[model samples]
Target: MSNEFKDILYEVGENAVRITINRPEVFNAFRLQTVEELIVAFQRANEEKSVNTVVLAGAGDKAFCTGGDQKAHLSEDGLYGPRGTVGLPIEELQTAIRDLRKVSIAQVQGFAIGGGNVFATLCDLTIASEKAVFGQVGPKVGSADPGWGTALLARHVGEKKAREIWFRCKKYSAQEACDMGLVNKVVPHDKLAEEVEEWAADINQMSPSAISICKRSFNADSENIRGISFMGVQSVKHYYMSEESKEGVRAFNEKRKPDFKKYV
Candidate 1:
């Protein structure tokens, strides 16, 4: 709602509100505060009468978002500030995006990895730049999004492709992502912003009430994933406490491959 956010930039334009993660120093990685700010921003946009579309983006050219700030999650007591089952309130953030009556678009310019990938998956449509790279790194990092990040993603790209994404943790280029049904369109890197604005303008010309009902109708099919997200995050919280999970983080910070097999 407020434009004075410490971790993100919220701007209201003609008929669209853009929320950009402003943490390029850390690849736009989200911490507790970042997630909280995002939730508030999305909620604000949802309430704004003049807004017909919400554009979710990240600052800088290097990344759209790399996911959770692992450094902030290092402390065992407060994983990312003890706000939710996983200490990130990620479920709430996801729900905020899902429940928004306005059409949501992911303006991805660079890396959309880990939780970032989930955000892209959750949006109503995704417009990517030619430079974008998309993937999941949860298994590699000793974590996994058990709900919408996984189940909803499967719906977008199919179960087998989704499994390959999560299990293999490989990065896909923008064209590859578009080919797989993940991205709606891919434009030149320099034209990314212009492309998103055009799409938003087109959406704004449509009937708001019709769009709202259509969005709700589409969401109804996957509404059950919300419940799955709740319970799955609880399980993730427990998994975070395990040595296996910690190993992943440690290995990441130490710049080495995790020895998850040893834990197994």
Candidate 2:
């Protein structure tokens, strides 16, 4: 499975399948190809009878994921590479994680920012290492996640903290995240894998069908999520394609502060 993916690492475990974003050079920031691969990997995990859980991580200690790859993002074509025309692949991937019957765990180590933070939030549980950091870099980078990034995040951390996260683009430590109810647990960096394995073992001992039903029940707020996310996604699509979006991207690439003071 590792040989098949160009942007990710897939390994089937005794009771779980571990999917790690492989692009560590960029702090594991994802592009269109990466999200598509993740959707397939999670779907495969959902189908396997022996697989009672799915574990998500990233390749390096630098970042679990930094969200969209700002270095080369072109917006419209990201959902399906350079050909397809949609920017909602991450949105689709979020629903996949939540809707799957098997439990999903985000084993975050570092830099789960912006959409990356959303991915971790949408999972049934998140276990972070002491080194992990969570926040949103979207507004600073010409983007935002209206999906799990805001609404669902508020479900975990409450409205005020969620707003602080997205609006300020500030970083939160692993302990800070756990304090806000954003993550289930925070382990020492060296013990992360063992802790996650223990959690997976606990999950594997549960009844699959019951867990499935529970996940569905938890996701009953889907209607409101879809409505809010639909508007957010559409708004961002236009924002991503706008001249302001290009200026932000250009400034990021240039390693300077985006002079947004002149925009409005």
Candidate 3:
């Protein structure tokens, strides 16, 4: 019940473990430490005898998570270099997501983009507010790798749609994402938490062991599927630091559309 997490808040209640991203100053952007904290939190929840479900959300009204911290990424070491760098703990986070034994739900409000979308898609179920916007904006920021998104998204929305989102950086509304099978449900902003709680309550009524077994069965089939590759850390860093990526970043910062037309 302590709100002591540096970048997130953790609480246990109603047989559920709730984790809220707390960095509203930058719209809940994920730092290396934040991702590491999430992995530990999820692992702890998995071990707790009293917890049957896990819920993830953001602290503020404006964003569930905007993505990685761009300012951090632009540092001298870049996003994938050495310890305490952006994207390094992402693989660990993904492992935690795949290994979660209990039902996990993402309660999304606004702007679940890039790494945020990756995190949400890691959950077993995604419950979004009608005002939420989901996108793979990493391409606009200079990389196309959505770390955990490569596998989870293709499973939810098909390879074609996933490719479009990743390669083109398309944004989808909550309703659109639900229609496309990205989100499980979309509710009003004011009722999102209530809806999630109601759904969690219903899910918790089922046999936890049975649910866990079924989830394991479903994941087993896709365990070896080609998804995000951590081996490409150097390549991703190179891409982001490339001239094209610089142009993409500049276009985004300048509020103009990127001219990737020529690159294609």
Best by lDDT: 1
Candidate 3: residue 209 lDDT (0-100): 88
Ranking by lDDT: 1, 2, 3
TM-score of each: 0.98, 0.94, 0.88
Cα-based RMSD of candidate 1: 1.2
| Candidate 1 clash figure, as a count | 0
Q: How well does candidate 3 score on lDDT at residue 222?
A: 76
Weakest 10 consecutive residues of candidate 1 by summed lDDT: 73-82
Candidate scoring better on TM-score of 1 and 2: 1
Q: Per-residue error at 113 for model 2, in Å?
A: 1.0
The residue-by-residue lDDT of candidate 1 on 43-149, one tens digit each, is 99998788699999999999999999988887765266768878888888999999999999999999999999999999999999999999999999889999999
Question: Model 1: what TM-score?
Answer: 0.98
Better of 1 and 2 by lDDT: 1
CA lDDT, every prediction?
0.93, 0.83, 0.79
Position 28, candidate 2: lDDT: 95
lDDT of 2 by residue, 54-165 (tens): 9999998889998878776753532324422245476678767877889999999898987789888888899999999998888897777777678888999999999998
- Once fitted onto the true fold, the runs of candidate 1 whose alpha carbons sit more than 4 angstroms away are 1-3
* Residues 137-235 of candidate 3: C-alpha lDDT, one tens digit per residue: 876777665445776688899989989888887889999999888899999999999998888788777887898898899888777642435555546
Ranking by TM-score: 1, 2, 3
Q: State the lDDT at 56 in candidate 1.
A: 98
**Index of the highest-TM-score prediction:** 1
